[model samples]
Target: MGNNHGSLKKEATQPQHSTTNNSKDEKKIDSRTEQSGKTLVDIPDDLMRKIIPYLGLIDRSNLAVTCRRFYEAEAKAGNSKNSEIWDSVGIDEKGKKVSMYKCFFEDVDDESGRYSIMRTKRMILSLKKTTPATTNAVIQRIFRATTATKMEKLEAAMQLNDCHSESQSEED
Candidate 1:
């Protein structure tokens, strides 16, 4: 009886050991599967430009810091004259016609992450133009006033234009 009992105990312990070994093997297989799924490669430049605009300014900045490829991509995209991508984000182009006041109000009203990018872009432009101090002061004033009066004045001008158009129609 003692021999039989000893044999049964050994059999039970063997299965438990086998199960543990199987689980460990399963874990190793899972790890390899996950690793195989991870492919490290450079993102295409055009795709990166499109994606950068959608990302928040901080995220875009961090991406630029990741590699020279990303930094160059961002700079190229921002400087593209045909794109107007930077202007859409409220950034003024270098040596290009831009309403400083309009850009300021646009930046102030823009709550999107593009605002930071616009500000940074403007600062860079200002530095290039040697007017950083003046530009900074103008931006501060725009923010302080919230551009409310400017918006109101624009609305008033539109209303006057509408009235003038209606009067001219009646005269016709």
Candidate 2:
């Protein structure tokens, strides 16, 4: 009976192995587990963008921190919601001023996992200044200038027109 019990215990226990070999097996298992799933990167861009709007601000920030691709997708999501931003702009009944304040993430450093959320107070049309009488036209231009280059060009053209009009009034 004692011999039979000893044999049963031996069979129940795993055979002792070198620590080095055990560690190697553990590493292999770890790698397999790590490689098993489809990560966020596996998701298509259109699907990712679609997913972004459903997330709240903090959730968006968390998603942005994951990788560059996600960060860009989040930013693009913001851009695509231009109508929401436009609606948020405060415009009184009078065509005097249209103001839209925007905050967005920029300057993402993928390696260091550093990013910046920049807030801009845009005075699309100012109350004190004599802006376009047609608020619709001004709003259209504001929304259309999606890129920095486009915005800058729009600003330059507006400035040039202002200067020319001022000179014409002076001549009169």
Top candidate by TM-score: 2
What local lDDT does model 1 show for residue 161? 38
C-alpha TM-scores of all predictions: 0.29, 0.33
> What are the RMSD figures for all models against the true structure?
22.8, 20.0
Instruction: List clash counts for every candidate, in order.
Output: 0, 0
Of candidate 1, the 10-residue stretch with the lowest lDDT total is 1-10
Which candidate's lDDT is highest? 2
| Model 1: how far residue 130 lies from native, Å | 22
Tens digits of lDDT, candidate 1, 1-172: 0011112221111111123546554555456445664321244666666666665544555665555555555554433322243333223333233354445335534644444334433443433233434333433332332223545534443443344445445456
